[model samples]
Target chain A: MKKDIAKLLQRKKKQIIDLWMKNQLADASLREDLMSNEELLEQSDELVNALLSKLTDDNLSNAESTDFDDVYEILSGISISRARQGFSPRETGVYIFSLKDALQEIVQQELRNDPVTLYEVSIKISKLIDSFGVVTFETFIKGREEVILRQTDEIAEISTPVIRVWDGIVALPIIGTLDSARTQVVMESLLQEIVDTGSGIAILDISGVPAVDSLVAQHLIKTVSATRLMGAECIISGIRPEIAQTVVHLGIDLSNIVTKSTLASALKHAFTLLQLEVRRKQKETSTLKSNI
Target chain B: MGHFLLVTIQVDLYDRLALNLEADLVQMVSKTGARGVLIDISAVSIVDSFMGRIIGNIANMTKIMDAETVVVGMQPAVAITLIELGLPLTGVHTALNVEKGMELLRKKILVDGEADNSDDEDQPGDGAE
Candidate 1:
């Protein structure tokens, strides 16, 4: 009976070894599967199970400590190549996440050369995610607050900047800081508003501005140039004293543009330039004559 | 420095209210000397360009008064419509609620006061305000 028990134990050990080898083969196949089809990357559970089952006494003893950085380097190369092949941003995020997960598992299993190597892999993965253009309102804000915040920003930034007047007079009141990106957005929105409204006069009020940089000044000049091309008069208003000093010091020229110190002054100037005053007088005269 | 103006509009007379709000706001600012005015839109749901134009007018009027006017508490759908219609509120301040509007107005008042004080010191004979 003792001899029989010993033979059974030996058979069980051999079977376990064979099973481990089979699992290793399966893990290798799954890795190839993930690489070929991006969708398989989300199947993390199956991949993790396959990797765990592959460990055996002999293989574990012989396994060299893996460097997660090496794996990340390989993954980064593959991701860039895929991106060059026209992979979408979402696909790139998925692919990067998969590689990060695998590397994390290896580190957690204590198979990595240094535990700190995991942090390096994580940083690379984050950089890759940023490169994927992962900016959206939903990602930044949660629930109904997202909608409200976005609406508020839109109203403050886009809607409040451009005002449409009767007879094609568009006024934009600028406040706060004008970074490069925001400047671009403001330019595009104003141009589109002018086109849609067919405004003959575009007034930009910078009264609320505290300062102006070279880049912002450049954007303003560009906006004026474009508006002139469309046969529209661009009026700038609210030139604060400090901003004026900066513009002069920076050698930015505003020779061709019309400027005013206030929105009321700008509108009055715009009305005169657009020849709307004569029309207003004619209407008033007609009304007076009819009343008489 | 923060003042609230509640202008009630009957459902059918909303259009008239939009056309008249700017003139009314100008008169109010002249009377109150408040730094900010908040127009509550919690009662009205739909707003057209006429209303938007009036809001713009109020914004411009406030600048003349050396004050700021913010349209507050507009329904979400109305806000969306205003955006889609390309209604211009240039020079107009907007806020999600009355409290926020007050906060913005107070900040504007403080900043303007500081600027005026500095301008006074810079140009002694000239009236900066």
Candidate 2:
């Protein structure tokens, strides 16, 4: 009469924790690499205790009930941590669902004398645990998404590097497909380097670009024009043969841009523009050569 | 007219100021019989299509008056902005600094002086690209 399920679960917290831990350990997906046995015990014990304290017959069917806030918090914490620890979906799913199995096993034994009450309570608890499993999955995916977002940010930062290849020339070799945002970064950094180094020539080697569409061409043009605006000539080098075919096929006008077939040629052009010659130093024919 | 008119535009120019300068420059070139015009715009920061047109007009007008015109000391930012604005500055010659501008003008005058006794009519101007 006085919230019998919550009171019973609270009284037998130790029994539930033992059974839940046994169920997890006996399962084949138990990953000792991700979490140690002692850590798993502590986490399982804490979650089971929080859930039992918050459990009530009224809130059994409603996992989102305010009274279950502490339970939800503990559940989400475990879920996100497992996600970061590289647990598979099935491993994590088994973790939350196994707790339900242990609880149901205890519920069946505790309510064996009254089948009707047992059936209703079992249904309610099943729904509640199922919803908690869903919340676990949601938080797990959110955690994974955060990791992916961080990786994307790192890629964007590292992909656009402007290198000073010569005393008065800079080269930017793009290794990925160019989007508008990336193109903007390339242009800003190139222009900044031009101003800093007083470089008159900037070489953009886009041989790594996979395809040549109109949009990619437009971004390239914008970057080139931006470089030129700095009163520096921009030479686009490393135009692959297929990319050249696509450019002509698309009728994209790169007439104003100076394109080279390789980075070496672009460097040579930069040297010519800067009036720099890479001369080979003659070896001193030593009088000591006779001693040798 | 005596040697060459050196106009150093130190501030951002408006339409009226630019047009007035162009008109005065043409008249001065003819009145003084100057051989070249050097407009130092390294400090003038802003340029729109209208300003680009005015600069082009000055170059063309001076050329018609038998004087070569050179734009010198254009800042990187200004050049970038002008290029983005679709003005490639094809009509007039551009130099990195004042010294280069003077050398360009001197070479032009030398070519003209040797090629003809009197400077002939100007060729049609190439518009902003």
Candidate that would win on TM-score: 2
After best superposition, candidate 1 residue A213: deviation in angstroms? 1.3
TM-score of each: 0.36, 0.69
lDDT of 1 by residue, A1-292 (tens): 2122223323344343333334433442334533543333323333333323443323222223242233333344445444444444455445334433443343334424544644544454344334322321122223235456677677556544577855778887777777655655666667667656656678888886668888888767766655553335688989878888899999988887887778888888887876666357788989999999
DockQ values of all predictions: 0.01, 0.23
Residue by residue across A1-292, what tens digits does model 2's lDDT show?
A: 4369888878888889999999999999999999999999999998887888777777877878998898889988999899899999899999999998999989888989988888888888899899999999999999899889888778878987889987778899898889877776777778777767767789999988898799999888888876654457789999999999999999999998888999999999888877788754543345446557
- Give the per-residue lDDT of model 2 (tens digit) for B16-44: 88889988989888888887788888788
Clashes of 1: 0
Best by DockQ: 2
Candidate 1 residue spans exceeding 4 A from truth: A1-161, A208-210, A278-292, B1-129
Correct interface contacts retained, every candidate: 0.00, 0.22
Which residue segments of model 2 deviate by more than 4 Å? A275-292, B1-129
List clashing residue pairs in candidate 2.
A229-B79, A229-B80, B1-B32
How far does residue A143 in candidate 1 sit from its true spot (Å)?
Answer: 18
Candidate 2, position A234, lDDT: 89
